[model samples]
Target: MSTFQAPKGTYDLIPPHSATYLAVRDAIAAPVRRAGYGYVETPGFENVELFARGVGESTDIVTKEMYAFETKGGDRLALRPEGTASVLRAALQAGLHKGGNLPVKLWYSGSYYRYERPQKGRYRHFSQVGAEAIGAEDPALDAELVILAHDAYRSLGLRGFRILLNSLGDAKCRPVYRAALQEFLRGLDLDEDTRHRIDVNPLRVLDDKRPAVRSQLADAPLFRDHLCEDCRAYHAQVRELLTAAGIAFEDDPTLVRGLDYYTRTTFEFVHDGLGSQSAVGGGGRYDGLSEMIGGPALPSVGWALGVDRTVLALEAEGITLELPASTDVYAVPLGEEARQVLFAQVTELRRAGVATDLAYGGKGLKNAMKSANRSGARLALVAGERDLAEGLVQLKDLTSGEQRPVALDALVDEVRKALD
Candidate 1:
């Protein structure tokens, strides 16, 4: 074994499993791409204040989980703990808001770093495929994002997930609700840290998962009840649009996301099979986030689906992705002379768009055949000095255990036909 290992709370995706991660990412990004969301990529790290101000200092992600550090130039930077803030910063920096298009749509797939005590479905380094629709406050946009996420999960055969929806009243009423919630929480018996959170961010206190904390929150004021008239109308329209599109969701009055910028619509996608870390994905409208990060007041909505969690969900629900074989054809050379010719043949087959692999190190026919079988290839191209001399190669149908001789010139065409 190598002396060094992957960092704690991190993993290395290898071989067949890595293919599944790619498929999940592509599956999640497909609907957004088709909807005109251009792909955007940002640096893996950004100015620490971007997340501190945009993601909210009170949230655990910023306060406890962020991987922040100082550079040699004395600038504080942080590995992005989440996607939206960095994405929004990029849009603002690029001046996408100045364009005529109301909402600057974008999609991204990459790894994010956090310093959490990792467990199942949570990691220090995780991957997410995210979509952001910036510069719009339309309820239809919110509904569209939710529908896209739902479609992505369904397309991947994830059936046991449910969407939880809520509204955290916007600027007009959130302050009033915050005061009420803080007042209610202060009266309860809470520790100094928990009580301090009520002053810093009262909504996060509601998100507390501790049994002791949750037990006292039963009668706490709900933001949905305190939503302003405009926010109420907006929330109602979002729900109506979702219903009209036949997407099912439950109104979760207590579903406050773990961010400070989210206002109006807030939601989460949960799968029971994931145990304690049930959230597969979630996002909501952040009408004030642009301004929070020192940009123009551009309203935006987006969601990020966890690639690792989605894979786990697939396993929990007993769904296999039915991935295509890694190799469509495996070439086996029986002798030294056949090796040179077969290597050229393998290259030609691959150049012709066939997934062909070659058995190297001069294995005997039996061992090479075993390697071919293990490759999950549907067909094996076998050639010996005798066959090569005859200007032909032996093609074995792995599934059917059938063999035939094909002219060397027709090898590529025959393999393509067999694959098709």
Candidate 2:
């Protein structure tokens, strides 16, 4: 019989490497938690229309990459490919906008799925740390989210990332810009799909990454050139705030993010170390998304940091986070009586807040010591019938190869002191 394997384009987080993923998630979440962003979690799947209506049906995430399926009851559902739409749906369902506190600040960390060709940084199953400030429209709010993400990466000792910023003009001015961009795009020698995209989301045509398509976009109408006075002013304020906070960013004219709801203030975190799939995280101000998804008017801004990509970025920089050992003390028992006694001591040590583990299956002294060493523990407690008869246990320091005997009753205290 053949053992089952993980599905293609996906992976199971395993071992000491899984620990790094956890540390990355925690590091990204810490700044958001400190900034009053409360934790929120939504289902892994949702009505297919939520993303179609919110993330834009024309985007590849909806039309090409979504893992959409029909359930037994004939309900259309899709595993969440991105976070903002689902998060907004949850906030609307809970009526969070009605509470008068303005933007309901929330943060979440979870695995998001997309049926893409798996590669180094891209995966069919990926994880993201998302934060949203819903129901408010403030440039400071946008800047706050960006600064928090910057601080998160900095706290992780990352120094090779760049922030690319832009403003995709708001409703008041976007329509006029859209018309001009469509006119310019229609004149280009484009393919059928690219031509169709021109009629649907014209701005995205400028985002086409194909060398053939990009060469023709050299003179495409710039969004900023058409920005109305209010949008221009709002964009300016967001830039000013980021500069004031000492967060450096580049103004990329064609940085229209892959979503339909975004309007005004858009930004992305890019790590040069990860070739091709360089975006580590990004989000923008979506002033009309709440109404689009059947909720009251909620102008919001949020971002999702790709845990997988961020981890790759860390590796690209050769950074290793100092992680605490899984086991602080490993107990090795030589006999059945010592096993029972040490088992009880292990429980007590754990209850007393010491990270402890024990050897099992009657392993001999040498083999048990090897197991103890592999537990990533710095200390080991070895007890036998002879040692217990003398009312003591042998404590060995794995690091310095030192050994001493401690009173049986004082095992926990002695371990704690030695660890301290």
Best by lDDT: 2
- Model 2 lDDT per residue over 1-420, tens place: 549988889999998899999999999999999999999999999999999999999998999999999999999999999999999999999988888898899999999999998898999999999999998999999999999999999999999999999999888899999999999999999999999999989877877889999999989889999999999999999999999999999999889988888999999999999999999999999999999989888899999999999999999999999999999999999999999999999999999999999999999999999999999898999999999999999999999999999999999899999999
lDDT of 1 by residue, 282-389 (tens): 999999999888998898999999999999999999999988888999999988888999999999998998889999987888999999999999999999888998
TM-scores across all candidates?
Answer: 0.98, 0.98
Q: What is the lDDT of residue 232 in candidate 2?
A: 95
Q: What is the lDDT of residue 177 in candidate 1?
A: 96
TM-score of 1: 0.98
RMSD of 2: 1.1
Question: What residue pairs are clashing in model 2?
Answer: none
